[model samples]
Target: MLLEGSTANAVGSQTLDLHRTCTKASQIFSSPGENFIQNKDTVKYGELIVLGYNGSLANGDKGRRRSRLALTKRLKANGVKPDVIHHISTPLVSKALSNKGHHSISYTLSRSHSVIVEYTHDASTDMFQIGRSTESMIDFVVTDTAPSGGGSGGSAQSTISRYACRVICQRSPPYTARIYAAGFDSSRNIFLGERAAKWRTPDGLMDGLTTNGVLVMHPTGGFSEDSSPGVWREISVCGNVYALRESRSAQQRGKLVENETNVLQDGSLIDLCGATLLWRTTEGLRRTPTLKQLEALRQEINAARPQCPVGFNTLAFPSLAQREVVEKKQPWVYSNCGHVHGYHDWGFRKEKGGVERECPMCRRVGPYVPLWLGCEAGLYLDAGRPTHAFCPCGHVCSERTVRYWSQILLPHGTHAFHAACPFCGTWLTGGHEQIKLIFQGPVD
Candidate 1:
């Protein structure tokens, strides 16, 4: 009934008597008359990793005695003695795992009952041998389970050791896909979703960091319920629609704002006012991957759905027939002359009439490049309006002498120039630097 050494590989092929083990363990781990092992069918012998440890203390609790006796008797009946007795704490687990002297480390199961028990031992060529037999010797597992439970044989206390290295082997891949942002292009205006490969999770349950491949696309209509029970919806990256969530909580995750829960089960689409689809993955949100695992979980549970879908350059809702105006529109360069003007296609005469060397009022000249350079400080003129283009500070100054002098005087100060930045009241100094650069080559 016992297994030892490399022969323990048979644990995958053995048939287990989980009913007997569960029944016995149920009595030991039970609280009074309640059977904590609700359903035994949830267990599979091939998946069991039974480890035992004798803690520093021992209690006279009957349940503890029962669990100890059960494990001891079972192993004794099977002619098995546990190969290793590890401390039931993080420090001990770390110490034990750090040592490379475990040559007897082998996974094995019972012949009569299918149950895997991780057998490990002191440094020796015959370390894995059970009762001196590397093939058939039965070994009793020395476990600290009973002592840690105050000899009550109840559920073990939660600790980093429990979830830290708790390994789960799956017949199927834990996740179905993997993806990463190969590149983000601005000139061409394209976002490439990991169109490279079909991503899959590791062979077993892994944190998002291990499977650091994911895409944060905006989903819509409602909360998306995952077929994977434990997996929840995460924000991944909150963009424009961050305010739309009706409510924000761990449970309300996967549910988009202003939509039903049943809608986005598998990712759907729906309208949500004039919102633009904004996306940034958990990876992008991260400056470092040290806490990528927990970070990924947070992303899934707080994912926001985009109110506005991409690909549709739109401003007004319900569709506009003629000319549509957006709340914030920028003026484009005329191309004929380096002037930042209305995006609207004005008649040639009209454009020419307005295309003056200077803004008669401000006296700023033409041949100017669209100055958003000042915007780096958060100042920019509302290209559609000639009024104050910067923040409420009223620092819009496009004059070169004034801007440079201001910056020199107040290094940290910002100005919101008409053709400037929004946050800081600074004029756009974009191409101005190039004009001052050395002329190394022939003049254009």
Candidate 2:
């Protein structure tokens, strides 16, 4: 029997016969044969090329002719004459998709038969009608039998028109989701959850998720391979998927899901069965960074420092742990002004583009070198160890000068400090700024 639209007034009788022949060819199930339809007449040519696909249903190739005929008829029924409908080859499918246009439609049977059609004319109202009706009308008959859920025909029909706006705007991977599940928390405490929500592809086929709803949280306290009856409902809005919390379930006492429903954004966190989990997109995984990119990052960091490494600044004081042993550790401290400080506490006053390092306490410009500010002359006569600190660049000043600089410097650079080396132009900071170096001892 001919399909509903097969005899529509828009399509000629010859086209209908070709569709019938193709349907018969599909039933025969022979191996793929040579192109049977090569006429130059646009409508006839489209029919024959589509019919070639009917001979053998290799992989996802079955029901292709039917879908093509159905789509053409649908377009024609809606008053949009398809100037041409070529059977895009499997190898050239990606290329065809790349060159897609607003008024063009490219439907092919590959892994999952894909239909991408855009409506640019004023007849979009009819296009919308066809898109909506054909969503249920289109069916891929595999081995002369239609598969469950209409066999990707629904996926093809529903996705194109629904996402045509996004496609025109050139937005990629248009849909996203955010999830908060306590099972994802490292501390296992759902209450103390992620600060930001994660984003992910809104494809409903993620493991325990389905067409209807997702297994909100398995009573087992973690994501399970098996799905529970109903914890959350998946709603499709303008081709984007969202998970809505179902009030029917009793497991909804978490901090993340206080509202009836949460619109999943790239960083929206959700609560699942008392566990807080963040939903994130896998776009990063799809784009793996190459080794060359990593090497360039390292090179960029190294270039920030001066070419000559010698005159670089070093940690001025003993380690934080050994502050008590300052007398023994740093013997050449510049302490004529009684200022003392460690590397982390030191900084520079902001200048135009950078900062200038100087003794804030006594107004002294110093790479303070060889100014002994240590234990008084016979305080540790028998002490075998030294009692003064020295800079890595051998520029030592009073210990009081360095310590005083820290007190005045830290407050100026609240988040971080930036100071240039007096002898060299290398920038320094307490922790890892752009460049940092801690000195164990005076550079010999």
Candidate 3:
């Protein structure tokens, strides 16, 4: 299904843990902020900044130290204390950025919970890395010319470079809306709305979006004459969480209006031009639940109900007999034909392996899967086996199945990798970290 932001949010909230730690979904990445003083630069709040390679290394360690010292002075003037800094080796930074991927840098920052700044051994390049609004990180590489020397013993010339600083800010609730259109399914759902400074729609906004942003446009028509003033069109008002779906119904113009509000609830449904749009305000829809959270849910579900209500009776036993087998106490079920064998005189054929055995009556291959578990891989659980892992989408499976899905779903690019829950239809986009959480086992 092609996912509009509104529909995806509803599915996500319904499938995964709707109540989670608040995290930002929109990240702002840019070059260093403009300089405020003759030699000082300003830092913005909520930015975990990294100042890498602040000077030329023409004078070896002495020149490098001079550059760092100059950067320190500038930061002090700007009232920034970069105490949680991590110094990365130049070779590592080059290898990481050269690959044109975010995993290496994202892993570094998340694993350390700190910012990274690296100076090239040549002192000509500086690199900084930070987490994005999504479950990823952005890298900024700054390269400059080599420092030069003047007259008098070719003494090293002073090259002043400003360091970057970011003020940590508290995280607020995330606001995301998902819209769904006809012919869109769980596999094809992507945010499909135009981001506009005003009510103007880009010719290509409905064509497709390159990234996730606010989309505030009507589905099948141009600007309406009866729209509420200033709030006529759909708008994401509060941090993209709360939205205003405003329109005036003129029973004459065929314009229908319902559910009037500026705040977007967890799962709100909207109908526009035969298109069903579901609205939701969720935190980190692009991210998956942590392993700890998933395990806790599993524990809660298990503790609440110690055993499966259906128990062993629901399990299917393979019958190899060409004729139907009957038992008064225990009924026999055919694997291939699904014909339930009742109490009769004919004896049934027995199979060696449930999955490998074929049906004698229909001559069909093994119907090895069941309703509770979609695939044969999860058959072990039905056999009274204990499971150690569960997908963030809430599928309980063996650890091996989790590993297999992880390798299969590892992201190839920004939007290339994804996995869907067969039972719930919720798509997981947080990559291997999310998959790993699926297998990390419950907490102690």
Candidate lDDT (C-alpha), each: 0.20, 0.24, 0.23
Model 3 worst lDDT window (10 residues) = 45-54
| Tens-digit lDDT string for candidate 1 (124-212) | 11111001111112121112222112322332431111101111111122211111111111111111122211211132110111011
| Residue-wise C-alpha lDDT for candidate 2, range 289-407, written one tens digit per residue | 23343334333423333111122333233322222233332422223332333332243445523333454445643343322222111111121222223232222222322222222
* Pick by lDDT: 2 or 3, better one: 2
Q: The CA-based lDDT of model 3 is what? A: 0.23
Better of 1 and 2 by lDDT: 2
How far residue 369's Cα lies from its native spot in candidate 3, in Å, is: 0.4
| Model 3: per-residue Cα lDDT over 1-444, one tens digit each | 112455434333322110121122212111222232233332221111111111112233241222111111112121111111122233343233324311111112222222121111111111122111111111221112221211112213211111111111112213112221111111211111223121211321111111212222221211111111122222221112223222211111112133433232322222221111222222212122333444454444334322111222222211212112222223223333433222233233357443333433445443221212212211111122224222333233344434333332211121233443322223433442122111111232
TM-score of each: 0.16, 0.17, 0.19
Q: Once superposed on the true structure, which residue ranges of model 1 sit more than 4 Å away at CA? A: 1-90, 98-176, 179-215, 219-444
| Sequence-dependent TM-score of model 3 | 0.19
The TM-score that candidate 1 achieves is 0.16
Listed per candidate, the RMSD to the true structure in angstroms reads: 27.7, 26.6, 24.7
